[model samples]
Target: MEPLAFSFDQPLFQLASLPITAGHLVAAAALLMALVAIAAGRRARSLRIDERDGQISALLAAQTELQGRIATMAEVFGARQAELNQTLSQRIDGMTHRIGASISEQTKATHENLRRLQERLAVIDSAQNNIQALAKDMAGLQNILSNKQTRGAFGQSRMEAIVADGLPISAYTFQATLPNGARPDCIIRMPNGQPPLVIDAKFPLESWNSMRDAPDADRRQQAAQAFRRDMEVHVRDIASKYLLPGETQETAFLFVPSESIFAEIHEHFEALVQKAHRQRIVIVSPSLLLLSIQVIQAILKDARMREQAHLIQGEVIRLMEDLSRLDERVRKLQGHFAMAQKDVDEILISSNKLTRRGARIETLEMEATAPPGPSEKGERAVDNRMGQLKLRVVDED
Candidate 1:
């Protein structure tokens, strides 16, 4: 049933599957699986390479940015740190120098304060010594004033000193005896045309001191009454003694214990004061003493002025007499001057007239001495070639 051309030499195996064998099939299948495995391995390797590259690039970029940022931070930090160090160093140095300067200044100030304190202490010591000296002087003064007469004398001296400071001593005088044969303490001249005034100093010391130092009330009362009586008596006595008829009146002065005493006199002893007034006795106290002194000073000044005027009256009269004589001499000299003026006028007139005569004579002499020409001599001469030309104009009527 087979084809007759088939040769017996062909292998039965070849004829059964010509190119395809079991081994071939297995080899092809193995080859194909090997290629797929190789391709997958290459692709995985490429993808891993690409991912590595991208991660590497991102890391590189981040590294570069970090480097730059680190550099900038380093620069800024270094600069700030340097500046902080500089500022701190300057502050430390300044503080140290200031400490040294302050110590020096404090030492100097302490020394100066010590010196000033020493000077103040010395001044205080000196002032204390001066104050002690003043205290001793005051004690001596108090002792001196304890005596009534001494106190009165002190007052008088003070008043006199004040007067001497402001005015001359010649302006004042004291202890003038009135016409009543009683000597007053002082007298003052009045201004213009007023009367003179007198002053008397009185002190009922024994009675007043008795009252002041009395230990018992009754004794004090008795002493006071006695002192009052004594004062009244003195008031009348002063009026009688100092108040003369023409020179002074009953309006004389009586000095009392104090301003308080004077005021008390006006209070409780109003009647006595009235009586004193009727007797023309004015009572003054220490407070009123200045006014009295001023009055007296004015009077003394006026009196001195009047006395000086009286003394200069003679000189004034002499001066006036000399002035009258001078006036008379001036009149005589004026008369002499008038006569000299008249003589000058007469001389001037005579000299003028003589001068006029002399001028007329000189004119006559000059006219005679003038040279005369031929025509003037009553003849005319002409040269041989020249003719004398005379022109006569007849008047036509």
Candidate 2:
């Protein structure tokens, strides 16, 4: 027997060529229904796959756009961050520089202030030392001024210094004995044969001090009165002792060494000054004495200039005579130079004539030695003219 073969299109078992039974029909139907179901299922699966692909494509496109946007945002953020960092750095640098400059300025100012403070401290220390020294000097002066004779000597010395500073040594004399046998502190000789001016340096300082240091008004008044009386007595004594008939000046000086005392007398005792003036005794401070000495020096200088006037005139006259002599000598020398120049001009003319004559003689000799020219007569005539020029040159010499 042959092997049985099964085919989907063919009947399972064919009875003859006629074939076909109900089973076959039913199998074929079942197979067709299965095929239809499979087709439907495939169609449904294809539709579902298409829908999912569309959804996936849409999601990918959206993701790609989102990625592009994110990239752009990141770039923008980076650029902004770089700019912000640069800006921040610049601001930080600026702030740091400003802070450094401010700190430096403050430090310099602090140092300067400290230096100035140190200088001020040094100045204060120096000032304090000077004040201490001045206090010691004041104490010494007070001690010296306590004694009357020493005070008088001090006044005399001060007056002498002023007088010596203002006037020449010959113009003034110190401790000079007057014609009346009274020795004054200084004597200033007046010019033009005027009487000698006497200066007395002693003054009533005790009463003035008492008046200045009185306790109350009554005491001060009494002290002022005593000071006035003492000054009046001094003025009277100076006038009587120093003022001579023809030897001393009518106005004598009572020198007050202390400017303060002099000022006090002028301010508070005008009447006393007037009284002294009436007695021909003028009150003078050290400064006033210096001024008076200067005036006297001026007068003496004027007198000296007057005395030397004739000598100056004589010297000027001698200078004029000398100038006149120098002018005369200069004129005579100029005349001699003119005569010498004329002689030199004449010698130059003679030398020129001699040079011309010698040149002619040389030309004649050259012509005579040459072969006789076409005109020997002309050559002989040239020689004769050269001889004549030589004779004229000798005559000029």
Candidate 3:
């Protein structure tokens, strides 16, 4: 038993006017179906293409309107930017001007302050120079006071200066030798040839300095006692050496160079002062010495005035005598003037008498020369009588 073989070439059906086999029919059917499908696809493709063209046109119109709106917005933004730039430039210029003015004012103020500071520095420099000079002077003064001999010279110089300034050169003498050969520091010549006033310039300042520099009270007390003793001894020496009978004054002066030291002695040591007074030793500072010199000067002036009193009186007497002589001469001149005036009066009276006699003679001559008229004889007789009377008047004048 074999199975039947199926083949497309085996004819199973007939077609009009063509060889109709099963294979051919089936092939025809396949071809027809493919053609139908191709037609449907073509129709759908045409419709889709039309739709795409319409969408493209609408999109182009909308893009054109959007571009116009963007251009308008860009123009507005540019105008606003220009206005902002102008405002910013103006504000910057104003700010720059204000900053410049502020800087100028600050510079001026700084210059003024610097000038004032320089002036103050100059003044301070001058004061510093003065202070340095004063310091040097003080150092020199301390050096001079350190040594005993120099210290005595300093005191003596100070005393001499005071005396020289207050008195004439001849009135005071420096280092005058006495009768006993004891030389004193200075001797003021008294008025009217009295004894000279002796002054000693040597003072013991070492004990005073020690007393002042003592740290403890006991040491200060011991120094004070030593100073008092030294002062007493110096006073005794002055009294012994300078106080001379009929040579120097009864009292002698102990010159203290320093005013503060003199004040200290007077304030702290009353007993020492009293003892010196009893010893006829007078302690004198520069001011006191000057005062005494002035007193001596006044006394000298008074003595000079008294000594020249007789000369002044003689001058006054001579002036009075000269005045009396002048008065007598003036009286003689007045008497001569009176006699001259009387002589002038007598000459004036004689001139008036001569003028009257000349006028009467002229009148008589004119009457005699005139011619006689109707009563010639009587007229002639009257004229002769008048002529005789005129002649008698002239003789009397």
- Report the C-alpha lDDT of model 2 over 20-87, residue by residue, as the tens digit: 75667788799999999999989998988898898889889999999999999999999999999999
Better of 1 and 2 by TM-score: 2
Q: For each candidate, what TM-score against the reference?
A: 0.43, 0.64, 0.54
- Local distance difference test values of all predictions, in order: 0.71, 0.88, 0.88
In model 1, which residue pairs have backbone atoms overlapping below 3 Å? 250-280
Relative to the true structure, candidate 2 has a C-alpha RMSD (angstroms) of 10.1
RMSD of each: 15.5, 10.1, 17.9
Question: Candidate 1 — which residues are off by over 4 angstroms?
Answer: 1-138, 162-171, 191-195, 205-223, 256-275, 295-397
Per candidate, the number of residue pairs that clash is 1, 0, 0
Least well predicted 10-residue stretch by lDDT in candidate 2: 364-373
Give per-residue lDDT, candidate 3, residue 340: 88
Model 3 residue 114 CA deviation (Å) reads 13
1 against 3, candidate with superior TM-score: 3
Those runs of model 3 whose alpha carbons end farther than 4 Å from true positions after fitting are 1-130, 325-397
lDDT of 1 by residue, 281-378 (tens): 87777556667667667766776788799678988999999999999999999999999999999999989877875675566455434344557333
What's the CA error at residue 319 for candidate 3, in Å?
2.9
Q: List the residue pairs that clash in candidate 3.
A: none
User: Per the 3 Å backbone cut-off, how many clashing residue pairs does candidate 1 have?
Assistant: 1
